[model samples]
Target: MGTTTEAENKPAESARRQKTRERLMDAAFEVFSEVGIHAATVEMITERADFTRGAFYSNFDTKEELFLALAERGYNERLELLRASVANIDVIMPTLLEQNPGSLTATELGPIVASFLEQQGDNRLWFLFQSELRLLAMRDPEVGKLFLQQKHAADQEFGNIIAAAFTAVGITPAIESVELAIVLMNTYEASLQEAIMAGGEKVQERAHELFMQRMLGLISQLAS
Candidate 1:
């Protein structure tokens, strides 16, 4: 009876732990986005999360650890969004292909691509958090190693998505799919930084559209 009771309680304990970790991550994301990693404190994260410092410590060793967790969470979240968007496109693949026979041009599919990218979390706060991490990775060796690992994973996942999308449309990328994926991502990030520096959310929004325009031109040139 004792063993059975403990077994029954284990799932509930696991659920509680999962919820606590999620709350901490959400709070860390907000705090890091608002104040940045360098300035953020564990206390700030716990306070925002409505949990005790003990609760924070139970789940994470340090602010940097939580930030890394948030990065992984962000990556997973964006990938899910991308996957869902691609699934929707997949539903219309036959129609899309029929409409654009022969090699696909960016002009032909630019809106679809732009729409997919635009849906990828336009939160300014998240963007700020990402920008801060990128700078940290550039300057800090420890952080840079982790950041590069995360980037490589994201690039591979995103490259697979792009490869599937283009293959569905019967168009092969002029370059290797993963390389194309990295180039597109790097270009988008550069444009986003320019937008972030230029002004407010409005500029950032316009920047995505402008990025799509330029990306379309580039893809047109690259894709036959």
Candidate 2:
């Protein structure tokens, strides 16, 4: 009876622990998003999650650790979204086909990718979070090393998605898949940064569409 009770309690305990961790991470994401990693405090995260400082410490040793965890979570979430969206090629195909009839050129497909990229969430929040991480990585050696490792993993996953997307449409990627992925990603980021810096809400509203157009032109040149 004692053994059975202990066994039954173990799974329940584990689930509770997982729930707490997720709650903490979710709160941290909001706090970090609003105030940034440097400005965010454990207390703020705990208060947002309605947990205690002890709870935060139980799951994460340091603010930096939590920040890294948040970054990893973002990367994983994005990969999941990409895989799910890729699985349903129809989601992308309609737009690509409508853009320019006949066969799906790389140019047409590029905009479809831009559309999926926008589906992740609020562009301003994402851009701010990413910019913060990049700046922090550049300033700190240890963080920089960790960031590079994380970026490489993310790049590989994105490259796989790009390869799958091209293969699905029956067109081989014109360049090395990873290189092409890098180019597309860089273009998207740079365009977003420029839009955020220069324009108002109107720019934010149409930023994704503008990016798609720019990417279509660039990808067409690159792929051809």
Candidate 3:
């Protein structure tokens, strides 16, 4: 009877634990969003979660570990959204172009790019991660090399998608095509960064339209 009772309670207990973990994660994200990765700490996180200090330590080994987990989660979520969006690129690309028609009006790409900044989200976290990893590699030169190799491979896969989208003509990308694609990506990032810093609401408009036109032109070129 005792064993059976314990077994029955296990699932319930497991669910409660999951709930607490999620609460901590939510609180941590809120804190991280408010300031940044470096500024957030265990006390800030636990206070936000309404949990005790012990709870924080119980769940996460250290602040760095927690930060990495949070960064990883954000990265994974963004990747999922991007992958899903990419899957529907055939549909999403054109619909946005059709919808917005005013001066510097935001199209679908605007919202998509905004989703990436994630409001309070740390864009710098990923950049810092890569930089730190590279720095560590310079010293240790062991695990870091393999880790970077894997990451670079994954990055290349995403790059191929951009290249293919810009030159999906089944034809090899010409020097002009590659140059245009690189330029378009750089332009989009620059404009988005400016939009973010400027507090301007709809900065993706011009770059987006310009890029789309460029893509269409490439497509036409491939067809011709």
Candidate 4:
């Protein structure tokens, strides 16, 4: 029988470590969402992930670290979605222009923007987790600093996507891309919160509609 070489084992070991880290993050997301970060404990996360305490410690030094990691993951996921949405605009705009053959108005742009910005996964859970992070940042300076850094990076990336989308549609933004990204994100979050509060069978649908309407108006007012 051949013995396993360290070189061969290295890839397997790395894969295992990555899998562990992903599981822990997934579990932490749920726990943190259900109970605020302050209330969430390592044991709770471990139990949710069905891992030992040692596993959690091996993956993360502290809950705050895991929280930041989760935030980063969420931001990356959203950015990917935004990128995909922007890419679709390249395909969409030509057909739209062929049909209309003139400058596209807010009415024409609203659905595209809304489709890209539409909430994915569980909105209420995501909103709760996001709200918890914001509150924690307000109270904890260290976490706030880290959170802001991550948020700024995400905003910049999203801003690039926005810029790309504007270019695709031959529209010049009146304001900076980052500022526009921030405004649009804030508006989406506010609309989501309201929809969640409204409490109904179609909260996500309503949220999308509300955001699309607000976005159309903002686009009209903000774009030249």
Q: Alpha-carbon error at 221 in model 4, in Å?
A: 0.6
Q: Compose the digit string of candidate 3's lDDT tens values, residues 1-224.
A: 34568779999989987888779887876676566656778889999999999988878888656655654565466556546655655554455435542221222233333332233234433433444444545565664555465455445444554444433322343444435334444554554444445544454554344445444434333222
lDDT of 2 by residue, 129-201 (tens): 8788898899999989988887887777777777777676556777887787788788788778887778688
* Count of backbone collisions in candidate 2: 0
lDDT of 4 by residue, 98-120 (tens): 77544677567666555566635
CA shift at 141, candidate 2, in angstroms? Answer: 2.5
Specify the highest-TM-score model's number: 4
The residue pairs that clash in candidate 3, if any, are none
Which regions in candidate 3 have their CA more than 4 angstroms from the true location? 1-4, 94-154, 167-190, 200-224
How far out, in Å, is residue 58 in model 3? 1.8
Candidate 3 TM-score versus the reference: 0.57
For model 4, what is the C-alpha lDDT against the true structure?
0.82
- lDDT comparing candidate 3 with the true structure: 0.53
Each model's lDDT comes to 0.77, 0.79, 0.53, 0.82
Over 4 Å off, model 4:
92-97, 119-123
Per-candidate clashes, comma-separated: 0, 0, 0, 0
- Model 3 lDDT at residue 183: 48
* Candidate 2 accuracy as TM-score: 0.84
Looking at candidate 1, the ten consecutive residues that score lowest on lDDT are 109-118
What are the TM-scores, per candidate, against the unseen true structure?
0.84, 0.84, 0.57, 0.87
Q: So what's the TM-score on candidate 4?
A: 0.87
1 against 4, candidate with superior TM-score: 4
